[model samples]
Target: MGSDRTPIFLCAALLLLLVVGLFIPNWLVFLFTISMAKGLVVLGLILLMRTGLVSFGQGLYYCLGGYIVGISGQHWGITDVALVFLLVVLAATLLSSILGLLLCRYREIFFAMLTMAFSMILYGILVKSEKLGSTDGFIIAQATLFGWQPEVEASGTWIFALAVIITLVALLVMHLYFRSPMGFGGEAIRENEIRVEYLGVSPRRLIYIKYVVAAVLAAFGGAITAVAAGHVDPEMAFWATSGEFVFIALLGGTLHVAAPLVGAFLIEIIRTIALDLAPYTWQMILGGSLLLIIFFLPKGLWSLLPKRREEEGL
Candidate 1:
């Protein structure tokens, strides 16, 4: 019965988001779009966390996605939005597949550091390549859908709608993934890798697959964010950016697939408010809030939702 209601709840939430996009101010809609993009990256991080892993370098894929979009439009003259997205996914997947072969062998801090190292390497390369605009990055051309360019006023709305659709589809797919046998292996590996191996599952192989999936998700996020912002930069791959995704993942928790989306929204809203209220001390404010959440709601904001009646024995 509970399983039956899950789809209904997700559909309703998606509808609500669509309604919100229609009525919200343009600035707010743009902010929401950015949050949704970041949410995708956080979603990938949550996947890794479920398997007792954390990536400090998801920014690598995120940056690659944005750069591919920007570079393709500027240099390659690739104006088709659909094709750009496809290329980004393909590039991210190929790169991640190669890296995962090496990364999947390690665990814990080694994994985290190796991920960060790869991301930083990209950052350094971008910073040195003046042709790619160095550290300043470059603007992305306006995108078209089905050969139709949006009027200036409607562009934000169009991008917002696209972001929403992408997020909903990704969420539904990830929800299914979480219930699959491989997803079950994530938990088992997290709990006991040796036991999982004894049970005829290859923990390393599972981790590699999860890593690739996470990279692809982060790439999609970067692609969408570049389109919404009309800009791409090396900063997108910076360690601080990756840290923000990790923070969002922790803030949202891994209990539910939707947690990352909610958490990303909350964080973006809080950051906006904090910057307005205390521009100089906004970082301090954000840090304080995280400390509070960690102390009081260690399971993350998602856990605050009321349990179902069945769960409560009612």
Candidate 2:
């Protein structure tokens, strides 16, 4: 089980996926691409969740990231995927870094609501912009990668492979992070902020770092989603979108960095099946699934993995 987290295993898995994705149907590739993107957001959310904080406004960064990518591609003529992601990092870092200063002071429900409120602020602004299509939104320009333009016919496959590569990188970084002293700081803060500070560590500082990281991951997710979907709209920043990320976080469990990706793929599968079976009542289906998962596996789907059995009578 520990071997799975190693960089070698991750790279091998990505290569296998790239090979498989080349032959898969475009629709399947698109669905998985979006799932991988969302998994990135959930991975970020888990960072905050471990620190005993939740952001119902993660969609704020997600939306902002997509809009920035779309605007840059459409208006500024920046279509290279690599350059676009750099822009996303810059924007997300600037916004979240400033917000974290004030936001780190809050905890529990206050933190969640403040995040949501800020998210809605952006939502309201986008909804009012006339040229940006108001509620209608707009399509993004086709993206190229390192000057390699995938033909329109093969774009889905190209993006699927790209998403896989990106997701693998995020997973490896987070794997190392969750093992480091600083990564464990969030857990310490979550268990007892007072005790953590008694040890000379500043809880607020940790929360600030975690919050900023989470926001940036969310923006990265948003950027990927925008590229995969070829469109962006206000709905991406809605409370429901943020709620979905939280839902995915819970469904995946916080035990491992890869959990979010597994949870996202499961969600996409469930959502696709639900929409096919019950278009009008899909929410009920999802709600029911959530209840079942919560009741049956409170630790989330990651708990289903075989445990690393302790050394026998060592």
Candidate 3:
């Protein structure tokens, strides 16, 4: 029990820092919140990664989520943040249910390719449509907090709050999931599906459930992002955006729950610097770093450190 308390303490400390950040004046807090929101998306990817599956179509749900929020809040005049959140989750659930039927069947590169195709199709539609605001994408009117202002100066702060709350909730849920019997089943499916089948568990059903869970989480990330940015673009569904999520997952080393958040922040910081430092070569540098990480770490940046593995079991 003492050993298990470590990740809990780390998580608590992280939340504490996020709370403290709300009181600070730095614009970086906004970036931190953005990273956390994106982290939620990667957190969903973490589940699929753990299941030994890689999805490139997560942007499909993520983009859909942003569109849902944008269309609802802007076109339908839905201004309540809570209501938007609910709608995003419901939309993601339905989308994933439909996508899961087709996705849960394919494995390996085929699955990844199929997801990429679906994502591109969504991007194309968003780019070509004018009523959906085309590439221009509409700005969100102020979101009301139960019919009250949440303080204009603290708009970023409230976003950060939402990010932290969503992340903590997702982590708690995943923690329980990892400790459940189904978790063991998931690992079994990841390691050897045929063996799990002999044990009488339905791998397909389990994966489908995981698929929906991942989609909902990704959608939550996207909806929050749209609200925070006050805009939505077709670029949100681009292949590069999907690749960025994968990069974050790989950077953090994906061995533990905290890995994705760490990766998300690190990538954001690195990209921020790279964009400021060398606009033209930023992609080159990013690509180079990714290759190096892949070649040297293979398992990811977490594997390079000795602290977590020996003590945390990740």
Candidate 4:
């Protein structure tokens, strides 16, 4: 347990990474920017996994986030980064809230398949929509911060900075969430929903809450990705995209809040280097890498760290 000032201390320490980020190479910064975006999505998976729910259709919200930014700028000329992010939040919340009603009733493989089906439906719709550029997709407008457009050369840096800020805020919220009883309600559900119900908690309600939170986080990640890449496509909502998210989620593990980011960076670095070294067999490299991790670090890469006394008891 931390004191009231823990957030202050944690935020200061996390924000210091921004200073280090300023010194990294441009390519590295871009890599990290995208990694952090995907990491945000995986963070939501971590939350859901702890509750014994695996969503294979997370790309629905991720795509919504990107499309919100893209269509807003294209049709409505809304390109302010902050405003589009707010739109992403609202859209994700609204849609997920509706779907979650039915989704929350399912568990295990049924939940997974329903999620994937919904994602594929969006992918199909995007592929057929002519104005949205069909399968080729369309470019989003360059995002501005509060109407202050960054120079072309500095736009990447601006996006990276936004990524940093968003990552920190999301991390802080998750840190607090995991410490609350509702957070533990998830784990308790995972262990035994019957026991959780006996304690006067509604497991379905908890799952619904987790599902919505995960969707919002995934959408936010998509918005960042759209702004950084300046593109949005039907592929963003495809089932394969959701599978990749699941890959990163497993690669990172669900043991800790930061595990997803750590895993995302590792996976990205591996994929980048492997693609350079063996483009034809990059997938093999990822498969092999995951096998090795599963063999040696069954709990995930986080297990490599020395355990604290409190964790040892867990």
| Top-scoring candidate (lDDT) | 1
TM-score of each: 0.96, 0.95, 0.93, 0.96
Residues 1-314 of candidate 3 have per-residue lDDT tens digits of: 23455447657867796778867775788778778878889988878888888888889888988888888877898888888889999999997899899999988798889988998999999989998888887787777778876777778787778778888888778766765678667777889999998999889998899889999998988888887888899998999889888888888876766778888888888878898899999988777877888888888877765664434642
Model 2, 189-257: lDDT tens digits are 988999999999999998998888898899999999999899999999999999999999999998778
Better by TM-score, candidate 3 or 1? 1
Better of 2 and 3 by TM-score: 2
Per-residue lDDT of model 4, residues 1-314, tens digit only: 42445467557855776777788888888888889899999999889988988889999999999999999999899989888889999999999999999999999999999999999999999999999999999999888878798898888887988998998899889878986899988988999999999999999899999999999999999999998888999999998888988888888788777788889889999999999999899989988999898888777888787765544543
Instruction: Report the alpha-carbon TM-score of model 4 versus the true structure.
Output: 0.96
Q: Tell me, by TM-score, which candidate is best.
A: 1
CA shift at 169, candidate 1, in angstroms?
Answer: 0.6
Instruction: Give the range of the ten consecutive residues with the poorest summed lDDT in model 1.
Output: 305-314
TM-score of 2: 0.95
Tens-place lDDT digits, model 1, residues 1-314 = 24445556877897798888899899899889999999999999999999999999999999999999999999998868899999999999999999999999999999999999999999999999999899888988889887888897898998889988888889888988987789878988989999999999999999999999999999999999999999998999999999999999989888888899988998998899999999999988888999899899998999899866543431
